[model samples]
Target: MSTETLIEPPLQDADALIADMGGRARAAAKIMATAPTAKKAEGLRAAAAQLRGQADAILDANARDMTAGEANGLTSAMLDRLRLDAGRLGGIADAVEAIAALPDPVGAEVDRAERPNGLVLRRVRVPLGVIGIIYESRPNVTADAAALGLMSGNAVILRGGSEAVRSNRAIHAALAAGLSEAGLPAEAVQLVPTQDRAAVGALLRAQGLVDIIIPRGGKGLVARVQDEARVPVLAHLDGICHTYIDAAADPDTAVALAVNAKMRRTGICGATETILIDRAYAAPRAIVDALVAAGCEVRGDTDIAALSPHVTPASATDWDCEYLDAIVSIAAVDGVAGALAHIDAHSSRHTDAIVTEDAAAADRFLAEVDSAIVMHNASTQFADGGEFGLGAEIGIATGRLHARGPVALEGLTTYKWLVHGTGQTRP
Candidate 1:
């Protein structure tokens, strides 16, 4: 569908291409690590200007992907993620500029101390050498990852889904032009120029060349990466996000949060998949009614099924489903304790929220839940990097070891101990 000839190579060539790219990325990472903040900001700002200035070309490329997706009977949600227009393009550019404007995290001193032996110790932030990003459907990620990687001083290799290859390439070209104009190494941000899936395997196994791998997509792709990757992976298993309506919750607030949290953007990972309502709430049915009116299909337990005829009886597996659609499962709980029990059993530990006026209940819920993101009296949809005051997200890490939720510029970096001392004799 692209106007230019797409050069898809053979499967055997994937290993060589990935290896070559990895070597270049490793080399670029060194240069990017020490690049001045002003230079990085200049390159990203130029890229933003280029993206907005060349909207027509980007939109045309997106049109090609949309047409092909429609012909292939792709679902509407899938098409929506792949399709882009002038507005979305402008938004992407704005995100890039926002990232540029944030304070640079590299070399910022986190802690300092003086030891008894006349030694000074300082811990300073440093870039994670090279990162590989594998994502699906969202062309915006190409720009987000590039901007964050450049600002955080890391070299990145991006591989978007096959469905959006044309759009991704077009976006990558604009970003590259800006980097070239600012004298930044274009290799600092590279897109896999092929559609062969074997390339993914090669990237996963690129152990020494890549420092880490972050996969953002459906469960199948993430599972494959976690299972096969030799490089350490930062990924989320599922966004089976939850919202609990406490017995002391204000009825109006509960209803509003539920509708917005689930139906605001049903296809996003932050969208709520299941809801738990306290049985003692005065108007339990009002929440269900509002959700159904907002075009969401409500599947509820027997207690909730009694609230409305429109409700469907939920089965056992609905407890752990990530619908990513207008479908939600609901259950009636005794109190905050019941809500926590339910969440503990079926949660993916990505995000959980509680809508309650009772401070004690909110505090308990917030402290006990072991999710990456926890909210009180707010929508689960706020689990995003930009909303958290970070410019843009590299990914939402549900893994515990390296980075946690809404990874941004700071999370893309590691730390090193800088030691300063006068000449001293060893004991």
Candidate 2:
């Protein structure tokens, strides 16, 4: 089939459409499982080339989505997430190429053991079969999902938000064309055609066909998928991430990191939604002042309110909210223990950071914080697969199971036990 025709067939019954896609994905996944790593790399590289070559066309489609988003009253942060310009497209293409350059995780032996019976057993990495990805507004997710899924030897069925349907279709077409050019089945990466909400329900119930479902969006969407999915789900509940300024923190460093953590692409899941300042810190006021100066709205407790006139008094709900915009909630804590307590009470456990010059304080915070990703003296914005050298991610898995942190190539794989024995029989 031609790439232009890869837009999925007309939507009929949602169940039947999902079933057909699931079956095709299952079949394509088998081919991908044993496909050579070099071929997979070639496919990803080709896709990157296609993205770069067709940047202008993709941007045009994205412009349509942007206009619609504006009409629909999407927040400035959301518009940023939905918007795609030439530079961002180039960055996306570069990320795909980086994925192609990474070492293949499949077939790598995770561990080996020899039993008393002289049986040599090995655990080897393998693909997770077909993955169903339901995400929102980010058109780049289409390419990221395709690249990560193909590189990890899995077929993907993407159900993106209606806001970016046109952009998703365009990006998916380029990806499918690249897969075909590399002799990989174009069916390896398929996007659900219709925006009907029923499509999500159908996909959730496709338990046997889809090995797992990964939902990447708001809390409501993730909760819905978790509640409705019959298949296993890899999800992040929320990004109510926090950054605590330790009592021993450097004033200059703390201010710089806090500003970047909250304002550098505020719409991303990694952006800091809350800032916890240690009461004993010499300059708690400085950190809050810096954030306000950087065009971030600070919603604060009494201490923070006292720091600046612009600081708005925070409500009870503000502490638990994930504001994916140019806003942050600030609170004062006693020390590391106080910060940890506050985080334990309200954090989504996605990502958290502490800025401190004290080695012991930093070590203690790192050891104590029960989050997927924790850092000392670094911006929470670093909680990303691309930043971690995994190219791109389906999502930051807040759940602890097969994966945690960035759901990259390694996280996408499962392992099987391979045993070698000489005519051994059970006693």
For candidate 2, the TM-score is: 0.97
- The C-alpha lDDT values of all candidates are 0.93, 0.92
lDDT tens digits, residues 1-427, model 1?
A: 5434446646667889999999999999999999999999999999999898778889888888887778778776688778798888989999999999999999999999999999999999999999999999989999999999999999999999987888999999999899989999999999998888889999999989999999999999999999999998989988999999999999999999999999998878899999999999899899999999999999999999999999999999999999888999999998999999999999999999999999999999999999999999999999999999998898788878879999999999999999999997779
The ten-residue window of minimal lDDT in model 2 covers: 1-10
Q: Which ten residues in a row have the lowest lDDT in candidate 1?
A: 1-10
What TM-scores do the predictions have?
0.97, 0.97
User: Which digits, one per residue and each the tens of the lDDT, describe model 2 over residues 243-276?
Assistant: 9999889999999999999999899999999999
Q: lDDT score, residue 369, model 2? A: 92
For candidate 1, what's the RMSD?
A: 1.7
What TM-score number comes out for model 1? 0.97
The alpha-carbon lDDT assigned to residue 139 of candidate 2 equals: 94
Clashing pairs in 1: none
